[model samples]
Target: MEYTEGVVKDKETVIHVHPNDYEKAGNSYLMAIVAVIAGMPLPIINLIASGVYYLGNLKASYFVRWHCIQAILAQTIIIPFNSIAWGWTLSVMLNKTEPTLYYGIYLFAVILLNIIEFVAVINTASRVNKGENVRWIIIAPLTDKLCSKKNKSPYPLY
Candidate 1:
């Protein structure tokens, strides 16, 4: 496996991922998914769960930490869009806001984006669990920037 920019061409980890670490990293993505389902009423809960996973895995190996950050970033991207939709939904239900063509269009867009994100998360989590380092199109660059080799993790990976 060729390592370049913290990514494995096929498979590898700079810090030598433990068998379980792979699962942990993959699970970081899944947590957000679980929260997404359970917290449909409050979309922010998914982000919160992913954030907590990131914090808990702060000391984990680079591979694990990288995946955690990616998961959180994914949630971060959808939160605002989801929030707007949720708020609009609440407003409509409470009869505080009138539904309109614009609202329907916007809600449809948000739901489409959310479904795409959901599929991406599931695919990424599955790959990570199988010991593959998946790089998300947008989230990867940001994660690499935030969790850099320059700022080495304080705790041991093993």
Candidate 2:
């Protein structure tokens, strides 16, 4: 584990980070993006890749674990929405199902959501690479819950 403590300057968090660890933490987000593209049809691939990365870094510092968990959580959130869109797309293409107005609306909503997530991912990755931590709205709190608070503990209860 490699890390040093720093105040996030926001009440939302107190970051435990190491400059040396930033690259790996940052790369995790990029990894998620790559996984998503590589498995475009399978929304689960990004989540699975994040899980594997998290597992591999079980003994990593708190910063790395936090980012990994955060990235994974984001992937989890995207999966169901992406899966639904993908399924509907296939159904429309193969089954010749009529596209309802609701379908168009849903697709638009999903695309917006995906774009938001994508921008957030890129921003987080870039910031982390620069030794800056970005705590997301919902995912940060969730990640903190899953990741240990103590500097010496990488994963909680492990």
Best by TM-score: 1
**lDDT of candidate 2 over 1-158, digit per residue (tens):** 52345324435665655566788899889888898779878888989999999898878877788889999998998889999998998999887888899889999999999888888899999998888878988888788789885655444322
lDDT of each: 0.82, 0.81
- Cα lDDT of model 1 by residue, 29-138, tens digit: 99988997788889889999998888887777777788888888888889999999999989998999899999999999999998999998899899988888889887
RMSD of each: 4.3, 4.0
TM-scores, all models, native as reference = 0.85, 0.83
Off by over 4 Å in 2: 1-16, 150-158
After aligning candidate 1 to the native by TM-score, how far in Å is the CA of 18 from where it should be? 2.2
